[model samples]
Structure formats: structure tokens, C-alpha cells
Target chain A: MNQQFKDYSQVVSQYIGNLPNDGGDWLVAQRSSAAERFTELGFPHAKLEAWKYTGIEGLLKQGFETLDKSPEFAEHAVLNQFLPEPVAGRLVFVDGVYQADLSTCDAVGITVGNLRSAMAASDRTVLEAIGSLSGVGDHGFAALNLATVHDGAVIRVAAKTSLEQPVELLHMATKSAEGQALRSRHLVMLETGASANLIERYVALDGVAYFNNLVCEISLAQGARLTHQRVQHESPKAYHLSDIHLGLQADARYHGINAAVGAAWSRTVIHNRFLDRGASCELDGIYLAGDGQLTDFHLDVDHAVPHCDSRESFKGILHGAGKAVFDGLIQVREQAQKSQAHLHNANLMLSRQAEIDTKPQLVILADDVQCSHGTTVGQLDPQAVFYLRSRGIDEQLARHLLCLGFASEVIDRFESETLRLQLTEVIRQQVRG
Target chain B: MLTIKNLTANVDSKEILRGVDLDVKAGEVHAIMGPNGSGKSTLAHILSGRDGYEVTGGEILYKGQDLLRLETEERAQQGIFLAMQYPVELPGVNNMTFLRESMNAIRRSRHEAEIDAVSFMKLVREKAASVKFDQKLLKRSVNAGFSGGEKKRNEILQMAMLEPYLAILDETDSGLDIDALRTVADGVNLLRSPERSMIVVTHYQRLLEYIEPDHVHVLAGGRIIRSGGKELALELEAKGYGWLLEEAAA
Candidate 1:
């Protein structure tokens, strides 16, 4: 069946009948227009310039549909390794539906809860963040998420507050969510003079075939700081797509890390814009793609104001028949003098069958701006391998060490010890395979 | 303890080492000094089991073992160390981690107890201090963005930790100033004993002034044409290699 033929009817119909009508008429009208946009845009294809290397034919052929109700899952015991311990706050979601019984919100200076409730009560933070930054205009995936998302995590920080511990959101899927489409919306708003750490991890059962589409919108007020960590470890047979939008005000700082390690096909698009001068965003990421996997990261940063700096460093380890694409673009506007933007993408192709495409572009329209981009897609340096082997390390272990070296620059940026250790083990296993 | 007889090697079908013969007894420092394009590094690399060189005709005997048959790590496990002319810069692997992993690997092959975190840290610190290397560099990526002198010091530090039976220093004095050369020479001299043998390959007589060599060999056109005592280095330095290259050609 053609993807256009199956259409977004099933998805729109399920959105109209989701849970309850507590989100008020505004949300209803917005969802209706987004549903129409979803129908018009449909699913992103290979012909699209943004998705030339990554084809969604296999995902669209899966024939996904929205779930009638939240699925029952009692496998919390086996998920301890995926969740870091002693976090300040933990919000658990299964198939995009908030599970309050399995969650705990104990952090100070924050009003954190389910997004559906925040939307129902017309929360001011949620109202400004949900669809404002990540609009449904050009991105079809974001539109689909805005039109069909049920329940997700919502975090609002009070001014002049800094949390001591990290806030975590664990999004997992079970067998019941297989063959279904799951959409989640995450909103994070930091008032002036506030700072917090956020971690959003996506996971599913082994070999589960599901579609996880998520949109995350983050807004930072003046002098606000945030550290965001996103880990996508979906099932080997699942399709995952995430759209992350970051808006920074004057003197606000943001640091983000994206670790993509699973899913048959996955893409994470991050959009960063400077709302005022003196803001800085440093984004770092690492990815591992093995046999029959396609992992991609696309980052777009706009330097519209002066005195803003944006830096992106991404690396990937691809083996077997895996394929990965990294596209990063940094644009400095004409009025944005003294803007500093630098992007780097490096990949280690560990196998003969692996493929990696890195495209880093910088467009500077202003004078006296520092802008540069560099990318490298290559196999492990044989000289470096020889250096390790000459030190008495075996060749296999040497290769694994070099591969791990490529990822350490990004992995070491995470503040969570548990998550860092977990990512280390994951990189080890991927190289060993 | 070390012997290379009629060692002939080729790289990319071009002969680099042509019928080179050398021998070093225990506790002896044999300096292989040669002009440019004389394949000084090839001999060191072949002995250390580096790949990419086709040893067309050569037989290396290390403690009476067929050295050419062993893999690179195997050769290293059996206590053969090569202080690379240009130490590789690994971008993200910590220097201390690399040292510890390498030490443990060699130890594991010898069926000895491995060094744990505490002991390894202590050992690396002492060794680094002895080599005049900064302890802070141990926490950084291995040799990444290091100065030339720092790289040479790192090589000596690795040599100190490994305690290899046969140490091949290939042009270890190429990029060091007088102070760094003296420090590195001191480190090399400290490692010298009745049981450890060393082959110091260099192109200058300055390093020979500090670490006195037992035997000096002048190699020209891929073959060693002159072999003499430490005085031979002074003679060659006084007079350029023009006469030696002519003699080798003749």
C-alpha cells in the first residue's frame, strides 16, 4: 500500500477521540489545523533535500496507527539500568502516556507534571512553549506530533533557582505499543536566573516494531542555564524521530548532548536560535549504528544577534552495514557582528560495509564574524592502531579503544555518572559487535 | 641479546633496507647513525614488528627467538620497545589510561599480577617525575597537542614503564633542545643495566655526547658502511657524510 493512500486519517480520528476534552477549544482548533498540515505534508521522503540520504520508505511501509488506549506494562524491574538512580525528579512515560504511579517529582523550585494536565489548565509556560518555537509549518514530523501527542513531561522552573540534581524522563515502550504510533511533547521553561539539568531517554523492548515521534521545546530566559541530555536507544525494529527546538535569551547558556545508539531508522533534528545577544549554546553528540541501522543528526543554528556563540561537535561510530548522516549548518546574519559559530562532525567507519556522510556548512553574512565548519568521515587511523598495538594491546582491543576514543569527547560531557557509565558500556558493546 | 643479519626489506616494491647486519650484546648501546633516506626507521620498525614492510630477506634473532614471526603485540609482550621517531597523538585516549592498559597487557602476557588503579597511578607519577614529564599531562589525551620535547619525554616515560629487554630508540633526539635532550638522555641512561640492551638510532652526535654509545655504525644508501667506537661519531661530525656516502657508493 502507498503511504499517501493509508493517509493520516487514522491518526487524526484518534486525536479527536483521545482521552478527554479537557485541553479546551484552543488546543482542539490548533490540533485540527496541524492535522490538516500533517495530511498535506504527509511523511518526509527521500526526494526532500533534508532527507536525501535517509529514506523513510521502510518506516512508512510499517503501517502504524495510534493506540486506542494506554497499554499495560509491568516490567519496571528490568529497566533499572536504563534509569539513573537518586535523581531529583523522575517522570515515567509508556508509549507517550504519562504513568504517575511509576514516577516521583521531588525536586525544589520547579512545577513539573504531565503535559496533558498543563495543557488542560492552560498553563502559561506550556502555552508559550508547546507550538511556538517548534511550529508545524515546514516539519511534517513535528506537525504529526503536535496533532496526535497524548501525554508527556512538562517542567517549569522558578526564577533564581538552581537544582542540585538532574531531572529525568524515561520514555519506554512495550509489546502492546508495537505496530502503533506514539507521539510525545516535552516542554521545558527556565525563568530568569534559573538553571537545571534535564535528561530524556527513549527505549523499547528488543525487536519491538513501533514508531516514536517526539517534539521537545525549550525556552531560556535571561541569565537562565540548562543542560539537556537526550539518549535514543529504541528497539532494533523501531522507527524513531525527534525534533528539538532551543531558544535562548540574553546571557542565557545551554548545553546539550545527544546519544543515538539504537533503532532501525532514526533521525534527530535540533534547531537552535539566539533570541538576544550574549547567549551561548554548546551542543555535543555521539552515535553508534550497527547492522541494518540508519542513524542521522541534523543541526541548524542561527546567529541573528551579536555576541552569541554556538558550537556543535558530533561524532559517530558505524560498523557492519550501518549508515549514518550528519548535517550541520551555522548561519550568521548580517547584523550579527562578532558572532562565533563553529561546527565539527567526525566519524569512525569501523567496517568495510559501513557508510557515513558528513556535511558541515557555515554561512557568514556579516563582517568581523568568526565562522568555520569541518567534517571528516574515515576509518580508524592505522597509525593510531599501530601505536596501540605496539604498546602491547591486541589489534581488536586496539580498534575498540580507538573507536571509544572517538566517542569519549562527547560522552565525557554528560554530568550524570550513571549515564556516562551506561554510554561507555553501550559504546563498548557496539564496537565488540 | 639482539642480532639482525642480512636484513633486507622493501616498502611498496622499493628496497629500503639492503643487507644490513648488526648485533648488540646485553648492556650494550649500539647507535645506528645514518644520513637521510638511509632507512634508519625501517630497521627500528621491523624489529618492533610494525607492518607494511616486506622483509624480503632478513632474520632477526631476539634472545635466540625468530623475532620476525611474532605479531606486533607479541613482540611487545616479549619485551621489545620502540620509541617512535614521531610518537602518535591519540586525540581522546587518556595518557594514563593508555599507559595502564599497555602495562597490564604486557603483564597479562607474562602471567604476572596486573597493576591496579592506585599502584598504576603511583607508578606513572614516579616514572613521569623521573623523566621530567608533567604529571598533569597524564590526565590529558595521549600526546595530543604536545610539544616536540613533551612527545619525546612521553616516549621515554613509556619505555620506563615497560622495562623492555631490547629498546629501539629511533631518532629519539630529532626534535629536542639541549635541556630536553639531556633529560631524555638521563632517562635513557637510568634504564640502562647489565640485562637491558638498547639500540639508539640518531642523525646527530649531540645525543651521543650525553648517552655514550658502545658501538657506532654509519649507514649510507641502506647499508652500514662504517662501524667503530664512540670516537667514530666525533670523526663523522667533524667531517660531513660526503666522504662516507662516496665510500658507500664506491
Candidate 2:
């Protein structure tokens, strides 16, 4: 018997039998099939080509026992530091269970609440959007998340509505359920001509050792614009796996910036598909790993229609025995004429033992497509260090400045000043350690 | 202001500077002319405390202190500057931020108060104008995507900002046109004073036309083959370096 798979299946089956089918039999069917899919796929191993550079053996061996019921927040003030000051329309989720008391939607025009409530109202939009992309049979972790998603976030913006303040979603893993796994599912849909700023953050309380599987599916209609920011800072003993699926229609624009600095081992996969003409997606990310940590970013941008454009830039800074991997793929179909895409991956390795594996793939099948990718891996430039030192900057400060500058190139693109400043400090702290 | 006695250096285990001797007084401008790979850059790098260059046998005295024993930043704090031939590009560090931090570091080392933002901006503007550096470029990354001329001008800007007591220009005019050369030369000349001395290391003589030197020395085969007054540069420019190589052999 595959012990790892059996452990997950047994826990999932027990949880499935306990779930209340209030949303009718459709939701129950979806949950059961998802569990079967995850069991068949099993945990990704090193043998999988896509997971070659990363191994989940240790994470699987941890034996993630499922929690019988959602754990309540332990009423700790520590959650304050993980959130932005003067919170604006923020949703707080602890152990994959949405906390309504801790969450508030300041904006009156936006519809932001928990998925469980929306399911009670028989919200077809919420139900259809939650597991819409999970039927494809890829992404075992995302399938697992769908199988056990008890409560997540549901955000819907009507046509021509604009939100002044960004909506922040905080997912925290508390120490109460140290050995359990938490699954989170989020659905974000914006109608035509709608605009909003969204922030999805993941954090784990100190010393929490759990598995967090999150799936966020987003759809932007024609002429819609969404700026999404994701910040992941899990505890050193926790495991995090996130999948983001974004679908953009004609004239829709999506800008995403992901900053990941915490977690013992984490991987974030972002898949953006442009389904209509004149759509554009811009994605930028920064990942820092120190000591024994491992961080990975896998971005795939697919252009199925013509006149679509995408730009991707992800940077990794590794110190000590840390390891990082960045794989960026831009695929343009044969019918995607006039499709333009650019991808760049740069890594800075501070320690000799640190390793970075970067792969930038650009496949253009159209005749008039413009696609290019560039990857660079190196330590700080000696010439630059000497230049700084020759001007009286100390050796240590000089190195810090260089690394900060490298990481800031991505953070500087953030549109929100509050997030930008906060993330700058976060990056500074990471670089300091 | 600076003295080099039987200074020898090697690069990557290969001896580059066999034995060189030089002396410069305050308020003096000495030019070192040499062929390619004759240790002009190696000498400058060694004085600036660059790594990987072994000082096989050398003694450099700067203001009566042993210069080689100090670290690169320590040497800079002591007022020794080397304007690199190829200025390094820091892609995300703002030029103004780099200049301000560098100036403050040196000032702090000298036990002086750090310059305030207003004063620093004012001072930078004044110095930038001297080099004809655009105010807009100050907001950009240090030397990133800058033209060769802009990079050379940036080096001169740093030199003017630091105000080194003994400045070493390592082929500063290599990639500049006549217009850029004049701008750089003017910036260097503006910094020349009675309390300061300069060593102009160049492969060509065009830079000397703009910033005339008090003394000129011809270096060939890692040794000073000849030394003369200011007119030496003109003669060397007229005759190729081969003539000096033959003269050194003879």
C-alpha cells in the first residue's frame, strides 16, 4: 500500500462523510469526485517532470491528518502584525476556515463574504466558479484543495463598479491544528468595465507545522481591470502550495505581483490564459530563501487568441544552503497572431551552497508572434561591489544595497503605496536575516 | 602627496608590474603613458585595494601612511580614488542614492556629520552641472543603460563628489568622443587644487591636450622607461609606443 496516498485518502473520506450537504447534491458530487481524482493522482514525486526540481517526499511523509471540524482562531494579537494598518475590506481565514468576525468589507459596492454563505443562497456564480477549472485533471494539490474546501472567499464585482480600497485576504495557519491540513478555495469574478485591487496573503503562526493547499480562480470580463497582489510568509515548519488560475477576456487587463519570503518549502503556480483579443497580463514576483528553505515559482501564460500580450519577471535571492526554482512558460497558439510576450528570470546566489534552477520557455506557433525569454544566474558583481566600496561604502552595506536593489526592481512595480512600503520593509528584513 | 618605491605586482599569478617607482608632490599633475598591458591599470587597481591582484613587492605611501595595508573603502576614506575605465552598472540603485551614500560614508569616516538631503541635493546639482550631467539621469539606476559617454561622465561625477586627495584616472578617455572628453576633462580640472595631486593614466595623448600634466612618464615592459616635462606626452603621441619599447631595450 502507498502509505502516503492511503493516509490522505482515509482522512479525506472521513471528512467527506462529515461535510453537511446544505448546497444540495451537486456540491456533494463535486467533492466526492475531487477526492477520487486526488487519490488517483497521489502526491507529486520527484519522478514527475514538472516536479523534477522540487520534491514533496518529506511533506507527504508528514502524514497530513485532516481536521474533523474547522478550528477556531485562538484569539491571538499576533495576527495584527501580519495585516496592513487601517485594514480596508480585508478577509481573514484561519486554517482554511473563513473568520467573519475578523473580516470586514468597507466598500459598500463590492460583494465580499465567505463561500459557505454564498453556497447557502444557491449562488450559481459562486458554485460554478469555485471548481470550474478543476475538472481538467491537472494539479493534484489544487484537486486536493477542492476536495476539502469547507470555507473560502467569494468576491464579485458588478459591471462598471470600481472599488477605491484594495480587498485584502489573509490566510493564517494557527498552532492549534499543527498536524492537520487546511484547504482553501477562492473565486474572484469581475464583470465588464469593473476595476478593483485585490491582495491575497498567506501566513502561518510561529511553530505551526501544517500543510496549506490553496486554489484561487479568477475571471475578468471585457474591459475589466484587476491588480492582484499575493504575499506568502508561512512558518518555517509549515508547507504551502498555491495555485492561481486567471482567465482574461477581450480588452481585460490583469496585473499580479507575488512576494514570497517565508515557509520551509513552498511552491506557487500561476496559470493565466488569454481567451480573447486585446487582452494583456503583467506578472512580476520576488522570492527570497535562506538557510534550508526552498521556494519555487512556476508561471504559465497561454495566449489562445490573437492580439494578446503578456510580460513576466520573477527574481530569486538565495543564501546559505537554500534552493529556488523559477520556470516561466509562454505558449502562443497557432491562431494567436500578433501575440506578444516577454519573460525574464534572474537569480542571485549569495552562498556557494545555494542553488537556483531557472527555465524560461517561449513557444510561438503563430507567424507574427513576438515572444522572448531571458534568464541570468550569478552572484553580486565584483565590479559593482568594488565601485560601491571605492566610494567609502562598507563591504557589508554595499552587498546589502546591491541585493536590495535587485529585489526592489520587482517590488517597485507595485501600484499601492502602502503595500509597496510594507513589502519593502519585509524584503529588507529578509535580506538582513 | 604620494610615493611608490620599487612597487611590484602580479595578476593571477603572472607578474604584471616588475618594479615601478614614482613620486608626486602636492599640487602636481603627473601623467603615466604606457602601451597596452604594461601594468597601468594593475597599478591603479592595487592602489585602490582591488582583490585578486597580488602585491608581490610594493610599498605605497599616501600622506605618510602605508596605503596597501588599508581596505578598499579604508583607502577611499583616506582620500584615494581610482576612476575605473569601465564603470560598473548597478541596475536598480539610483544614481543619486549611490552618490549620497558614498559621500556620507566617507564623511562619517572622517568624523564629519552626514550631509542633509537638501544640502546633498544642492551639492549634487552643482557638481552635476560641472560635468554637464542631466538632472533626469540622476533618478535612474547607476550607469544602467547609460551610454559610454554618460558612464565616463558618471565616473568623473563620483571623483568630483569624493574630492580625492590623489586621483587616478585609468583610461578615462578611452571610449569618449571629443565632446565627452572635454566634459570629463573639465570636471577633473575643476577638482585640481594646491592641496590635491593627480595621476593621469592613459594609453592615448588626446586627454592630456585638455588637462595638461606637469610631469609625463613613459612606462614600457612594467618599468618607467623615461620621464620628462609636459612636452614628453606630445613626443610620445607623435611617435608610437614601439619607439619607447626599443629605447627601453637599448
Q: In order, what are the TM-scores of chain A for the candidates?
A: 0.95, 0.95
What's the lDDT for residue A136 in model 2? 29
With a 3 Å backbone cut-off (N, CA, C), the pairs that clash in candidate 2 are none
For candidate 1, the iRMS in Å is 0.6
DockQ score of each predicted structure, in the order shown: 0.73, 0.75
User: Which docking category, incorrect, acceptable, medium or high, applies to candidate 1?
Assistant: medium
lDDT of 2 at A299: 92
Using lDDT as the measure, which candidate wins?
A: 1
Candidate 1 chain A lDDT trough over 10 residues, lowest sum: A75-84
Best by DockQ: 2
* Chain A of candidate 1 compared with the true chain A, TM-score: 0.95
- Give the TM-score comparing model 2 with the true structure, all chains together: 0.92
Candidate 2 C-alpha lDDT tens digits along B1-250: 8999998887888988889999999989999999998988888889889999988886999999988889999999989889999899998998999999999999999999999999999999999998888888999999999999999999889998899998999999998999999999998999999989999999999999999999999887788989999898999888888887986798
RMSD of 2: 2.8
Candidate 1 wrongly placed segments (more than 4 Å) = A1-7, A18-26, A72-79, A82-85, A119-128, A335-338, B239-250
lDDT of 2 at A183: 75
True contacts kept of 1: 0.69
